[model samples]
Every structure is written in structure tokens, then in C-alpha cells.
Target: MMGGLSIQKQRRLIVFAFITVPLLLLLTFAYYPALELIRLSFTDWNGISAEKNFIGWANFKEVFSNPEIFGVFKNNVAYFVVGIVQNIAAIYFAVVLNGKLRGKNLFRLLLFLPYILNGVAVAYLFGYVYDTTNGSLNYMLGQLGFDKLSETSWLGNTSIVNYSLASIGFWRFMGFNMVIYLAALQSIPNDLYEAASIDGANGWQKFIYITLPNIYKIIELNLFLTVTGALEVFDLPFVLTRGGPAGASETFVLKIVETAFQFNNYGLASAMSVVLLLFVIIILSVQRYLLRGKGE
Candidate 1:
């Protein structure tokens, strides 16, 4: 009993025990892989190779210089644009649903339901909806006596193919964005609105002067998520079109996968991933800079 471990030592041991496992996991799974990716980015190693030849920044150079390689960003732009529109729509809808309307919770659920559904399944469902023949959209159009519109190939035409895929993303993410906005809206103190009302402020004025200011940080968060999500979009297109119609809808991340697995260009793929990471940092930095005085 006299030589028993002190309480201080026991507390320290407990703390160490609690943190040790998580620290090991982070190093092994997260830090190690990220470091490996950066290392691989500088090498010209095919996916299966044990020998990774250091090639400096040739992969990066190719990424920047080659029009063919950078062209995939056009598809990403579609998602970015769609995401912007989706955010606007979601925020507005969130505002409306925040009103004293009946069945608002049901409305919120219906909006958020798509987001909780399986992404692959939604893609497949939309893929069928956009099918060239016997698709629901075409069938509906035909029924409406618009045979010419009915014949239009939604997913096949290169011109609108990216947009068609982005529409699916819009459908899937609108609810999620709305839920975010709604949560932010709910957090604002009702006292602010009462004060606004006492000051002869109407709904629109209250939204602009009170609601908007109160939820500024949340709006910033939604903007960041929208941009980043746009950049990293892969699943919808991969599931629906497989980036088909002659790579018309191939997103940036999809192209990365194709580079590594399909073309055995792991080095380029790794470099692309690095570029994407840098892009996210740069984008969020710019976003913060622009939004500085306005929001934060």
C-alpha cells in the first residue's frame, strides 16, 4: 500500500491510455497515407510498381500545360455553377419553410430525404430517367405532345451532358443545403426579429438586416461546402454515365481515378490529387478573403 502508484501517476496513465489508440490510428491511417501520397506525387511509379522513379514536377507541368488534361475542369465548372444555383434555391426555400406554415417539418423531411438516400441508387434512378429511349422524361414529353423534345437525348448530347449530370447533383444536394440553412435560421434569436419589427422593419428587411447577418457564418460554411463538393464530385457521374459520351461528363476526381487505374499513370494521378488539394486551399482562401469584411 505504501509503494502503490500515486493518484497523479494513475491519472496520467489513464489519459495516455485514452489518447494512445486514437493517435496511433491518425498516424497510421491519415498522416501516413497523406505523406505517402505527397511522396508518390514526385515519382513516376505505375500503380503496381515497387520502383518509384523520382521525376520532379513533370507530372505537375503536364497537369498545367496540357489542355487535354486541364479540360476536365470544364465539367467541374458545371457542378460549381449548379452548386451555386442549388445554394440560392436552398437558402430561399429554407427561409420560406422557416415561416409559420403548417406541415413544414414534413416539407423539410421531403426535401432532406433525397440527401439521405443512397447516392448510387439516385444516380441509377436518374440515369433511367434520362435514358435515350423509353425514359420517363421522354415519355412524359411525348404524352404532352412534344415529340421533338421527347426525342432529345439528355445524357447523350455532349453540349448539355454535364448539365444533365449536374441536375442530378442538384436534386441530391438541395435538401442537404436546405437543412443546413434551416438549422442556421433556427439558431437566430427571436428577440432580434422582435426588435426589427418594433423598428418598423418588414420580413424582407428583417431577413436582410437581421437574419442574413445572424446566419453569416453559416452562409460562409455552405459556400465552402458547395465549392468543395463541386470540386470533389465523382459518384453521380461515375454511377450514371461512367463519364461516357466520349468523356463529356468526366469530373476532375473521376479523371484522377482514370489516370491511375485505367491508364496506369499513378504519378500523374497523385500529382492531380495534390493539385486538387492546393485548389481547395486556394479556393477557400480566396473565399475567406472576399468574404472577410462582409461576413466574419
Candidate 2:
């Protein structure tokens, strides 16, 4: 008004002012860090060093060429498998909970309680559960007449260690996924189900046609999140196994942390991070393409 600006122009100026602050914050905190990661990927900066020598493609080349380095993906594959199973279970439970049930609220609370619990505490709790000498799991198994199985090392043995850690991830996240699925399921129009039922559509048919179609987006979103989380799994392995048993349960992200901190190779860690970012982007793109195609 002092500048004799029109009301529309004044409103636009206000909107721009409001938008600018958050945009600047996002650029500073999120985008800047991401771009820095990309920049660091091309250099040999040992985190604390004054010199950041540009190494071109050498870090990426070594990441691929080193079989021992790339083999940690197998551990991720185990988590991905568990994530897939977790997604299925989540959806199944969500569907069931969406329907009428006795003590539904209690069950829902119980199912979601673990997701809200402290992750570090859960990891520590499982450590005791999987302990060799006096763990409750072993005691219970032995009591149930599985002495040989109870004697097995849940986190020590290389063969099943990844799966053991993967189970922790599965348990930790399934309830959250179920809550997502439950919300998506509840959002669907019940009228659609009623119409399908009136047209002689059974539960399976209604689910296949109406439910799946309505919730397909949520399903894809869950799968994307689950797969990405699986690829980035680090906490359980870090806290429980420390990626031990000769690196049998190390995750890609854990490897990145190890390279940057433990091994003092920031360039390689950044390159690994860049690779993981690219891989996640590719996966997200492919999933959207396939899901959009199927939707059509």
C-alpha cells in the first residue's frame, strides 16, 4: 500500500514472502546436504582431511569390482524378502481389522504398540532374547522339545544370521505398515463393495476388483517404502551383530558408515551413497511405470 501496489500484487508479495522462508530452509538443510554428498562422491576426502582430492570414477569402479564389497547386497536381499512377507502380513491384518471384530481396538493397539516403541530399546531387548546362554527364546525352545534348534546361534552363525536380523526388522515395522494399509482400506467407499456384492461378487472377487483397484496406490507406496528400507537396513545389524560373522549380515548402509567412519574412506562412502540413491530412484521409477501400466 505504501508503494501503491495493487491488492493482488500485495497478496502475491505476501505469498512469496511466506513461501520463501520454508523454501530456503529446505534448500539449506535438505537439498544442500544432498548436493554436497554428490560433490563429495567425486573426491577423496577422509572426513577430517583438509584436502579433498578429486578421484573421478575410481571409487565407483572399486565398489563394483570388489566382490567382497558388493556381496553385502545378499544380506539386503534377505531383508527385502522379509519385507515382502511383512507387507503381505500387514495387508492381511489390515483387511481383517477393517472388518468387524471383538476387542478390535485392543488388537489394533497391540499390533501398533511395537512400532511406536523405542527402536534402540527394541534392539537391546532382542539382544537378550537371542543371547546364547540364558535367552528366553532358547529356554522356551528347549522346553518345547527343540534342544538342537535351541542350541543354534541366532546371531553368530553366518548362514541364518541375516534372516535372524531381518526378523527383527519385520517385527519392528509390520504394525506401522498395517496401520497404513488399514487407513487406506477404511478410506475405500463401502458403496463399491455393496454394489459388487449385489452383483453376485464374492469376497475374493470384490477384493480382487474393487479393493485392490482402490488401494493399489497405497500398496505400491508400501512396497516402495519397504524395499527402500530393506536396502538401507543398518540398525539391527549394527546394534546386534555389528555386521559380524565375517560380514555376513552387514547392510549396504552399514557398509557406507563403516567406510566413512571405521575405514576413513569418505570418497568411497559417498560413492556408495550415490549408487544407493541412484538404485532407489531406478526402483521407484520402474515400480511407478509398472503400477501405472497395470492401473491402465
Model 1: how far residue 268 lies from native, Å: 1.3
Query: What are the clash counts of all predictions, listed in order?
Result: 0, 0
**lDDT by residue (tens digit), candidate 2, 205-236:** 98889878778888899999988998898888
Clash pairs, candidate 1, are none
Task: Compose the digit string of candidate 1's lDDT tens values, residues 11-69.
Answer: 88889979998999999999999889999999999989799999999999999998777
Local distance difference test, per candidate?
A: 0.90, 0.90
> Which ranges in model 1 have alpha carbons more than 4 Å from their true place?
1-7
Q: Return the TM-score for each candidate structure.
A: 0.94, 0.94
TM-score, structure 2 vs. true: 0.94
Global lDDT of model 1:
0.90
Give the clash total for candidate 2.
0
